[model samples]
Target chain A: MGAVIYDRVALIGLGLIAGSMGLRMRADGLAGEVVGHARTARTREVALQRGLVDRVCDTAAEAVEGADLVVLCVPVGAMDAVAREIAPHLASGATVSDVGSVKRDVITAVGPHLPDGVHFVPAHPIAGTEHSGPESGFPELFEGRWCLLTPLSDGPEVERLARLWNALGSHVDVMEPDHHDLVLAVTSHAPHLIAYTMVGVADDLRRVTDSEVIKYSAAGFRDFTRIAASDPVMWRDVFLNNKDATLEILGRFTEELFALQRAIRTGDGKMLEDYFTRTRAIRRGILDAGQDVDVPDFGRAVLRKGTAG
Target chain B: MGAVIYDRVALIGLGLIAGSMGLRMRADGLAGEVVGHARTARTREVALQRGLVDRVCDTAAEAVEGADLVVLCVPVGAMDAVAREIAPHLASGATVSDVGSVKRDVITAVGPHLPDGVHFVPAHPIAGTEHSGPESGFPELFEGRWCLLTPLSDGPEVERLARLWNALGSHVDVMEPDHHDLVLAVTSHAPHLIAYTMVGVADDLRRVTDSEVIKYSAAGFRDFTRIAASDPVMWRDVFLNNKDATLEILGRFTEELFALQRAIRTGDGKMLEDYFTRTRAIRRGILDAGQDVDVPDFGRAVLRKGTAG
Candidate 1:
């Protein structure tokens, strides 16, 4: 624990990311006091019971009343309304940030509603699990992950926010919001959309049957299933907000897929081999870059149990 | 370790699956005096050095001289030549099986060449890692994984092969060759094609550099990279041999992907959320079936290491 970066930090929307932030902030004494607000009273109660927050407020307005830092950790679609409701209650000169995946859209939706003298630095911590809700969070979620801070301008507030994330155990990177979206499209959004599509296709396969697909899924389709199992509403909002970049990446993916399909239909083994070899290099690069350190066989640890059955 | 199922078992290739089979069979004493052969002397030497086989032969014919069971573990494209080379030298009443991802193609390639009194039972083990070669294999590779046997006949020979696989630590399922191909198309082939296409698209992106894609890949693309990193020659053979089924499943995937893309374009959150929710259920079904046991946050274990940078 270090010196408190913010005397009081308010987190709106007590879900996985928000709850994770609360736990991480408290663990490191990044905030003197942590408060939280959720749309439903049940979630607020869960957050309080889980010790994700020191105080649980009934409304976002009340949560931000005396807090030096307020983070909008809700879905992208709900950010505008929350910003409108809490703008009047924000403390003077307080730094306000958001944990939305889409940055340009978030800035567009929430920037105008903020009161004067408040900072609107949008950030995205590229870390999560398939699990959601306040109970799904742990203090170690952000360790060794990259957190992107998309600020319109560089100043003391942005530096402080970066330092706070550093304390939370993330390697912080400052990027333009558009670049962040395009990079995310290439790395996260498009892949997730494709995984969802693949799982949907397998589910809708009449010939193979869903039961067989599920039973034999350990081969390869299981990876797609894991990615597709993420929170539905959060992903829906992500696609709706980051439409342009996601669509563009999807277009490129479609083109590449069609070329491979053609190669397969034509019996062009060399073409397929060349393409596979090239893509294989990217996986090596990811491992070399330390972005992915998972074992080649992910389920080995689980399978190593005494009972093979 | 248990009683030997075969006096001498011949593995006709020295790759991950075959090497793992040798290690596992030796570990459990499933086969007496396991021998192996590969087209390249380098692979033979590696297999011998790694103890993947007791005797590494220079020729497939030499490897199967006195063996009661011969497993063709070469790439799908190479199965025909291997079957031709080893057919004349096989012991009478010996059982022959191949671990090719596509069954119908293997049957077509190797069925006519097998001599009378010899049994041909095609099997496809639903297990592998991105790493290849003899050194990559381990005794536990087949534990808790499925090995699909697509035999043309239901007889004692098929049951023996099933028992052999069971002894090696895999759940065996019997299906018709054509049905196995289609099921694998939905579960393995098409998903692998999509993953390769996604990685290729990211590699070819003009705006997003490869470094950026690799760095931010911990989000979702990392999973695709792992799938796409599989053996290039093996995957090429898979796409080429399983063309019709893979292409059909890919067509369905494209349809589903376009529907989601349109939903994103029109801001149809309901449709997107509904589709994601449905796919999420399939993931749950897969987990419930015990096909996948790892928590969704695969990166956490690696991230927990002391080096945050």
Candidate 2:
């Protein structure tokens, strides 16, 4: 929308987030040179051919060379290696950040490797889809979404770089790294784990029922399946990276789950009614807060994808 | 599409399902005459205003009189009272059916009171939206959806009625009444209860942090809360009716949930990975089965009412 924020920006891992970053930067005229890197030559070539970046480089170091900003868009597990690889090549005073789902994990994994002169800012853009690869990223992905930046109190330069996200198209929030992880574990990770697990259970039942699972899934199981179809490797990395917070929130979830099980087992209609009534209110609050885009029904939206049944 | 299947079709309650039935019947010329009735006069007025039925009757008895087909379309808990109110007035050769969530309970509640010559067919159309009332109905609601019918085999009349649904939009599947309840409990009722419970837990957390439980519900919580917002009285009746099946399935879900909790607590990334991977296949199967309609995400189909957010 205005002059470029940085003369050159390096995107490590030309996957969904990075490719999307490239698209967004190009659309908004935010970067002079959008350099993308992938370890595999084939992926790097594909990224270049697909016009995902102004330039393609096979190594993170090459991509970061002379770049004013560097963004690590790989899985959280891969952050340290990329950080170390690109650190020496990053321009002096260049700001480095990421689009990792877990903030504290990224800081721990990538922070130590960043050079003193290159500012390191850890951030998480709370948005995505099940699709992956360079083709999946688009400029509009971050519009109106929350981008949380967790910077050390003394790191003013890094904090300023984090504000670039707000300039691009995001509402910025500042939170302690650990708090970010804990809140996400409850809001996103745990819920995903539950959905993935329930879908697996339903699939197992489908086998015994001679394929009735998919047949009748429209009744409920289909929603779980759609979420479960997410990129497995990325989710595995998320759980491994943010172990403690996930475990903490999961404990609370199970305690509540068991109480519900008890209500169902003993036919405590009153408890069920009370619990159900309370939850319905939460949905209303969501609507009032405008956190959720109003969709008539999840199943109906699923139908629109038209990719699946 | 063909000659009207029945000379007269009486819809006992003009809510979503019943109104939908009337629309579908008119669209395909599946009924010779469509009559609507509701417990309250206001609903009848709304039905007539919406042209949901050809004739709006003042009483349930008046609606059922001389109709070749009668459908009881009320909450599962109300099956007994509605059935009794309309039973004596039903024409001798008329076939009576229902669109309830729980099969055994509907059959139990409505079976004994039916006249000797009248055929009783219990059906559950495994489709709905969070919104209720006459305005929620649409002709395409049951398109490509499964309709489960549990009917005694002795009557040719019941078989003819099954043909009627086959002529309409639904794919009809017949099963044992008790087994129907069990299957639905596993696939629908139990999941709805768990969703309601989890949203309740999240709602409690919202109270403490004043967080946006509904607003920022990613995929899992968003989907859960959407299903949880289903009609409270209808869900309560469903739970009361299908207590045994729901409790049995809830037991299985809790056992699985605790194992997952333990996996998270112990930092067993491999176990979590194993479970998450297992679930992705179900999405593929649903996609292959053509049951889950795909949308951008699992956002709901847009509703014209703009009432339920």
The number of the candidate with the highest lDDT is 1
Candidate 2: how large is its RMSD? 3.1
Inter-residue clash pairs, candidate 1: none
For model 1, residues A137-199, the per-residue Cα lDDT tens digits are: 888788777999999888999999998899888899999999999999988999999989988
In model 1, the runs with Cα more than 4 Å from the true position are A206-210, A302-309, B206-210, B302-309
What TM-score does candidate 1 reach? 0.97
Docking class of 2: medium
- The residue-level lDDT of candidate 1 at B256 comes to 85
The alpha-carbon deviation from the true structure for residue B208 of candidate 2, after best TM-score superposition, in angstroms, is 2.9
Q: What lDDT tens digits, residue by residue, belong to model 2 across residues B121-211?
A: 8888877777688888877777777888888765787677777777766788888888777777767877787677667667767764467
Q: What is the interface RMSD of candidate 2, in Å?
A: 2.9
True-vs-predicted CA distance for residue B126, candidate 2, Å: 1.8
lDDT of 2 at A298: 42
Candidate 2: what lDDT?
0.77
A1-309: candidate 2 lDDT, tens digit per residue = 757778898999988888877887877788898998887887787788878898987678888999888899998888988888887787898888898988887898898988888787778887677767876766666665677878776566665665678766777777789877777776788777777766656665665576776777655566667777887778888888888877766677778877876765676778767777777776776666544555445435334445443
